[model samples]
Target: MTRVDLNADMGESFGPWPMGDDASLLKTVTSANIACGGHAGDADTMARTMAMAQGNNVGIGAHPGFMDLAGFGRNRMSVPRGTLQNQIRYQVAASVGMARAVGAKVRHLKLHGALSNMASEDAALARDCYEAALSVDPDLIVMILAETAQQEAVRELGCRWASEIFADRAYNDDATLVDRSKPGAVIHDPDLAGKRMVEMVKAGAIITESGKQIPAAIDTICLHGDTPTAVQIATHVRRALEAAGITVQTFDGR
Candidate 1:
């Protein structure tokens, strides 16, 4: 059977501000990328998310981001290779421990926000993050941008990778995401997003902003839990994929 993984970034609630509708999202997505005390999550939020994920019987993955909470980890920092590796290791370990505390195991390591962008484009950063996760737990799968540096590093390091695509985002000519600052960065219409997702998975291609078709591998689909209609988007995508005869599952069998 053809299978696809459905993942969502969870645990993004900061001190007093609640960010995504995680509880409903966790019910729909197969994998939960729990934030590892950086970018947007705190200890309480992480613990709560972990508990909720466990209750819903969902697979767990570590969502490690840069230590920049003010910019929500979207702003890149000029950290050395070694510093990046160490920070990634620390965050992954924290999430690993948190999962183990609740008798759950982290199925993968997914870098978030700026860290994900950097690792996907910079070979050195990709290798650093890949090596750090492998050292921490070689069994953990690495979820990354489909065609970027992290995927390349996964190939070189012989680590498992889940090629991920976004369901509600626009693609540039090069197949990378359009800059969020751009006018048409995100697709807010649920019906349009659902149709685009079906086309992306079934045909394995995305229509770029310039009306060019680019090959896309859809091993996993990501829905930003922080979006206003994240829950509706996920629900619609799941139905569309299932109706098209694709099995929506997590990276690791659950």
Candidate 2:
């Protein structure tokens, strides 16, 4: 049977601003990518999220990003290679510490937002992030965008990797995510989103906005927690995949 991991970014609430209702979302996804301190999480939020994930038996992952809290780590920034590697290492290590405190394990390392996109195309940034993740824990899986330079670098380091696909975002012919600023970039309708997800999982391919079919070796599909209809989209997609006999689980669980 084919299996795919359902993951979402959680623990984003920092200080007085509360983000997504992660506790509820935890019941839905098999894996939780908890945000570390760099992007959008605090010590209290991290502790709470880690405990909740442990209680729900959801596998935890470190979601590391640039140290741009003002931009929510979505804005591109120029930083030295060593600085990038150190920041990623600090965030992942912080998350691993929190998870271990609650008796939970850090199963993977997933880079967030702009850093993730940059790493996909930039060999230098990818190598830095890959090295940081392995430095934290050599056994941790790296969840990276497939068909990117980062995947190649991660594999060269002998670390396990999971190919990540987005359920709500449209893709270009080159298998890159369509710019969010463009029209039709995000599928907000739950039914349509469900249909797209079903097509991708069933065929192991997705048709881009330019009408080109792209093959994806998908081991995981991501649903952004910040989306308004995220829960509905996640629920419907999970049901659709299950009906098609695809098991939902984390990479480690598989």
Writing each residue's lDDT as its tens digit, candidate 1 over 1-254 gives 77898899999998799999999998899999999987889988988899899898888899988898899989988887788788888898989998889888888888998888877778678888889877888889888787666767888888787888888888877667887889989877778777888877777766777877777667898899988989999999999889989998876521
Cα misplacement distance, residue 79 of candidate 2 (Å): 0.6
Once fitted onto the true fold, the runs of candidate 1 whose alpha carbons sit more than 4 angstroms away are none
- Kindly give the stretch of ten consecutive residues in candidate 1 with the minimal lDDT sum: 245-254
* TM-scores for candidates 1 onward, in order: 0.95, 0.96
- What digit string (tens of lDDT, one per residue) describes model 2 on residues 1-254? 78888998999999999988897788888888999988899999999998998898888999999998998998988888888888888998999898888888899889998888888887678878889878989888888886677777776776788888888999887677787789988888877776777788777876788767778778888988878888888888888888878899876621
Count of clashing residue pairs in every prediction? 1, 0
Q: Tell me the lDDT of candidate 1.
A: 0.85
